[model samples]
Target: MSFVIRNIDKVIVGDGKVLSNADIYVKDGKVSAIGAGLTVPENVEVRYGSGFCAMPGLWDTHCHVQSSGGIWGVDKDMLPEAKAIRAAAQAEPVVLSGTTTLADAGCDGNISFALRDTIAAGIVRGPRLLICGYMIRMTGGRAGKDTEGEVDGPDSARKATRKMIAKGVDFIKLGATGAVSSPGMKQWSPQLTLEEITAACEEAHKAGLKVHSHAYGDEGINLSIRGGADVVVHGITLNDENLQLMKDRSIQLLATLSTYKAKLPYLDKLPRWQAVKHIQVCELLEANFKRAVKAGIDVVAGTDSGMTFNYFGRSSRELDYMVEMGMTPAQAIKTATISAARSFGLDHETGSLAAGKAADILLVRGDPLADIGVLGKAGGVAQVFVAGRLVAAFDECGKEIG
Candidate 1:
């Protein structure tokens, strides 16, 4: 399919640049050209972009699509088929919210892989999915009861990494610290040792896959950095040394801020231990985030969606938090666009509006450059295209339209 978005008010190039009053020509599921007065074939469809702001589709680096029911309601015992169905149901809302690419942080069994493959095969309507089949953790680590990748020593961790690769995972998710959701575990309790983490990272790197380490405390964060993790997820208790190590290693931070922020209104509904941990983390999040930014760390946007009150389709709110913490509107947008693509090694294909890139484009009603919050507002996203195909279109009232 081929089409052209004519007279776009502005094109956010996703790399801190914008093209004004340009025409975007898309053909064969990729951007053909981006310039004024671009001519197209007679059979191509042309859509008016006069009222819309064009930009690269958003990216969510940390998401759990298979886990739905929130905190107390999350049932780890759900049948595999049921989990897959629920995940499939959640994909549309995510794509419609302007996210064209996302990484499934972890999933039960092989549900994430199935969802990703089905989407690739056109059997499902969703964004591009990169998934880690199950998060590797210590035997008694966080969420051990929910996932199957629990290991103990370096050998065990190496074997677990190989198992995930055999399962055809896109990346390896390592649990370096305990989590807030686990009732018996303290959030700061370091779980995986440096040796174990190194084993897993080495195995994953050898297979040409990135390692995303789930860490919260200083010890875990430092261990992950020393272990050669490609990206550190959460990173709540970052110290100066950790920051220096991360900078020296070129490791990006995927701060899932929305998850902590989303828990505020529902603190009363959470378990006492969980609520306390959430509050503590929320208190430190902004200060630590600002510090990381000031220290010149590369930050990526992720909402930890599908967890507690952090629902899907609200992923763009992470950008608002980023701007509020320190980043400018353009910098925050880059974190979710070009920066995110670079993190996933997808910069060569889709991150921005270029002459030869996947047409993963988002059209919004207002200028996101002036107000980053507009991207999170209702009825803000007017259209969403993935691989040059219009998968979602919303009316002025935020209702889905043909």
Candidate 2:
């Protein structure tokens, strides 16, 4: 299929540049040309926009499509088919929100790989997916049988990683520290031995997959750094040395916040001890990331969506929080676009509006660069495309393209 998206009033390159009055030509699911007066064959589908701001579709680095149930992550009590159904349902609205690519952080069953395949086969309308079948953790760690990749030693870690590789996970997810949401758990406490984490990272890297480290506190953050984590999930307690180490190593940070469910409404529901612990972690989130921003760390964007109250399609709210923390609007968007792509090893395929990348595009009625908040508003994105094909094009109130 071919497409000519004409008369785009402005385009956010997903780098730091913006172009005006540009047109995009897409052929075979990739961008063929990008400039003014780009002409295509008459037989190609022509899409004329009425005052739309175009840009690369958004990228969300961390998500949990399977964690659709209430607070309890996985109900082993539920049938596997039921789990897959809810997870699939959660994926539908992501493109409508302008996120054309996302990754499932970790889930109980290996259903993530199945979902990835279904989406690839065009059987499902969702973003391109990278998935971690199960997150490797220590026995009795934060997640129990619900989703444990429980490994006790280096050997076990390597074996578990190999199993995930055979299961066809695109990447490996590891929990280096206890979660902040489980207030009663020890904060900043290490869950896996450095040796175990090292083994997992080494095995996954050898298998050509990256490892994402789930860390929150001091020691846990350090273990993620020294243990060879490629991406840090939430280093809310990172210190200066940790930031420098990550920068020197080129390790990336997902720097997620909103999806942790650490907000007041959720916290109020927590037990006093847990709520107090969560508040401590929350207090450090902005300051911790600001230090990262100052150190020139590769801070990518991710919403630990599906955790507590974080929804799937509302991933753009993460960009809003990023701006509030310290990034300029452009930089914040870059974290979601180019930076995220680079982190996930997908930059060559998509994440930018260049001529050779995948033609995953989004159209908003007004300029998102002028008011980044517009991206977080309903009906702000007028259209969404995946692989150069029109997937969603309408207003919030049901106005279809004329």
Candidate 3:
């Protein structure tokens, strides 16, 4: 099957440049050719996105569809069945909203990937799956205080990484610091020492995979980077030393501003002791990100969607927050399109609208370069193509097959 989308208002190309009055050709699910006014071949699927703007489909670097946790709090027995249901619900709004690739945050383990496989195999429509198996944690580590990621030594960590690799996980996740929700645990508190994180990263890399660590403080950030993590999920609090290390090591950051936005309304409800912690996180994130940009560190746009106070699939809001934080609209788009793919090492395949890449693209209604806010508006996607298949049309929900 082939498609020749003609007369697109603007085709946002790979280098973050938009071509006016363009046409795109797709064959065998790869972009065969893209130019202006090519002679249309008979019998190819043709569509006119006249009032639309095209760009690479949106990508969400961080999200958790389901795991042993409820919508807002911990749900210890997050069975595969429950996970599948939640993932299904989560997949719709994202796909319909124009996202094609979404990276699952630290969820699923060797013990729970069949559920992920089921969601991938079934009728769910959204981003392609790239998931971290169960989070690797130290005994009484950061993720769940009650339910410990307690691996005894380096050997145990190695064994756990092997199990996740054997299960065919896309990457590995390690919990490096205590989180806000985990009561009595302070943010930036290091959970796994250098040796443990090194063992896990080495084992995963040896098997030709990458590691993404959930770190917060300077200690956690430095240890994860030194251990050779490909990306640091959310290290909001960093000192000059850690910032330099991150820049020197070339580790990317997934700054999740939306997570903080969602928590604002509940500030009064938080325990007196924890109230300051939330405020501190918000302040540090804004300040540290400005420093990261100044230091030439690559920062990707990621919304920790599905966390407490965040919407399920509407991650476009993150782009708006990025502009408010000092990134230009073009820079914010680049973060999601180009920089984001580099973070996952998938830049060669799906990041931008380049020839020979997978035809994962979206058609928004206006010029995103003028205002990033246009992407967050409803009905922005006129159509969404995943691997050359017009899975969803404008204002359409699911696949439309005859």
Candidate with maximal TM-score = 1
lDDT of model 1 at position 246: 89
Question: What is each predicted model's overall lDDT from 0 to 1?
Answer: 0.89, 0.82, 0.76
Ranking by TM-score: 1, 2, 3
- Against the hidden true structure, what lDDT does model 1 obtain? 0.89
2 versus 3: better TM-score goes to = 2
Sequence-dependent TM-score of model 1: 0.96
TM-scores for the candidates? 0.96, 0.94, 0.91
Clashing pairs in 1: none
On lDDT, the stronger of 1 and 3 is 1
lDDT head-to-head 2 vs 3, winner: 2
lDDT of 2 by residue, 1-402 (tens): 888888889888887878888889999999999888887888988888548999888888998877662554335477777878877777888776788888998877767877888889989888888898888988778644564578899999999899988988888999888875554477678898899999999998898788899997778888988999999888887888888889899999889866644355776655576567767877777788888888898878898887655667778888888888878888888988888988767788888999889998998877877777878677788888888877887786535553
Best by the lDDT measure: 1
